[model samples]
Target: MIKIDELREGFGSFWGSVSEGWDRLRHTAAGALTRFKPGEQTALPDRGQIDDPLHFPAQSWSMLGGDVFEDEQRLVVRIEAPGMEKDNFAIEISGDTLVVRGEKRFEGETTEGRWRVLQCAYGAFQRTVPLPAAVRGDEAKASYRNGVLKIDLPKVQPGKPTSVNIKVD
Candidate 1:
């Protein structure tokens, strides 16, 4: 037979009771209200928004691109670009998308008394964002302020889907 003192000492005083309370809390109204509870990872991306990123042409990188928001008048894109100038960046639009391409270049020369390291990439990066509908590419304006580049694109009305019905005798 297990003594109460031994049970308390080994179970951290009230572990079993706390575990039951946790299970109850997990199944409470808050948990039952929505079925989108936290779940374990079962497939690639885990986010469920996209499946198998390797199959897609675009690659998602946390250090590459960022969010895009739009308003009634215009669509805006803000990219986090550090240690780059406006001259090194270029923005262009093709079809219903906007493409940003830039190349990073850095060189350093140091003697024995000093050490230098070129940590930034020197190749090139291209990021393309698809628009909701259509945007005026010619009038799209971009500005680089601080370490962010903001692109303002003129927004256009979205197209409506037509309904189809069939009549049978």
Candidate 2:
């Protein structure tokens, strides 16, 4: 017999895969749109005209993607953050939420010709992921390597209730 927890897990996995696929498709479409005729112009602002380094246009931004899964004793989370260093990320677990925040700074490039296309996103981004089960935040471990951030959180074990005897007052 299939249990409810099993069904839930199956659905969660299915949805996560779908969401990741959709994000990839959207990014591909946006990149393709930037390769139009040079003479044809849109209302979008030129990268050179933007004075503020933090200003990221809506159409040019992309969010970080990740996956979460649990093993027998640990809950693991892996996030894709390409071109970022270890010091660039700030991760915290508050209550039942795991918050990952970071900024991908734009590296200025000096080229003789003007930029014809710019699709990479560079700015501050935050992603909050809810824990599937209770975990010990204090004992959590994290590591970043090869543009991927991996976190391992120890799962909390349920303990037996303790009964206290009351003395007559």
**Best-matching candidate per lDDT:** 2
Best TM-score among the predictions, by candidate number: 2
* Model 2 pairs whose backbones collide: none
lDDT of 2 by residue, 76-149 (tens): 99987787788878999988889887766655556555545556665566677778778898999999999999
CA shift of 122, model 2, Å: 0.7
lDDT of 1 at 39: 20
Off by over 4 Å in 1: 1-62, 107-119, 158-169
The digit string of per-residue lDDT tens for model 1 on 1-169 reads: 9999898798884887898898886554231121111122211222333243343212322254456786667788887776678886889988887778775443333432332222233335666666665788878899988878899988666334224698988
Candidate 2: residue 35 lDDT (0-100): 16
